[model samples]
Target: MSTQNYLVISALGKDRPGIVDALSKSILEFGCNITDSRMTVLGGEFAILLMVEGNWNTLTKMEESIAGLEQQLSLTIIAKRTEQRDRSNPFLPYVVEVVSLDHPGIVHQLASFFSKRSINIEDMATTSYAAPHTGTMMFSVHMTVGIPADIHIASLRDEFMEFCDAINLDAIIEPAQR
Candidate 1:
């Protein structure tokens, strides 16, 4: 017997206790096996991104099995085949981490900077914690981005420094190894 291929499934909604139970039940009903997954609660919302393997033709059935889950949990579900091309090595991989006092427009500024350079942000996570008595908020963000091999890292670093100075935020960029 050969191993079955896999598809990726992503779901997100308000944070709740039963989201995983509901999701697992649906996956089991379609005879799909979840090989790897990452689930996290961000700002009161639960997000799950999973990699599942099953019969190639079972994609549609798997989707249907989870359709009602959206209504039951009031969540959004997205399922798609994990394309082989997307699994290949990247041309250039890099990481950018930012930490600073909580403020608006940070994401917008950083995202726009990367977008202008044709960089692709593959994954990103951000969180903020407020100090109980100090009334100061701390913000932190981590992102894995892919850039073309032709782009210059030095130039990117310089631009990021300028951005950091303007926003009074500290930023760091470094090459990410595969």
Candidate 2:
């Protein structure tokens, strides 16, 4: 059996129409399948994170063409080889949500909470906006974390709630539906 070759690529440039089209077309031409991707406009910049998989030769050919692609698309591209994540000590996925008045260090504090417990944050996103009616600046965080199966759910929930309370954040921790 042939092993799969995986490449993770990040492209950032000024936001524009057809960036995805151009990049994806190149991947298709090189015979690679885009396994995962996250594309978003951050301020004036368009950022992309993609994982593509193919056979060794096809991936190499694609890598060789990245420089030209960058020039054509006006993107700064970075690519690296990676393997599938190891899940030997698998985690039970949990979703965490937090909302509070906008302030500094919220993300950092939340990360510290999980890091201290050796929890893995698999995905996270945050946004700030004006609160409806009140017009107060509000911040919200959504994160997916990996909890070790050995950890007791009830105790973790209680601790997380209390921690949020101390920080004046309204939050919830629940098992991820998916």
Poorly placed runs, candidate 1 (over 4 Å):
1-8, 71-76, 80-82, 85-89, 131-133
Model 2 over residues 1-178: C-alpha lDDT tens digits?
5489899999999999999999999999999999999988989999999999999999999899889989999999999988777889978999999999999999999999999888999999899999999999999999999999998889989999999999999999999997
> Which one is best on lDDT?
2
TM-scores for all candidates?
0.77, 0.96
Model 1, range 134-178, lDDT digits (tens) per residue?
969989889998887788888878988898889888888888877
List where candidate 2 sits over 4 angstroms from the true fold: none
Q: lDDT of candidate 1 vs native? A: 0.83
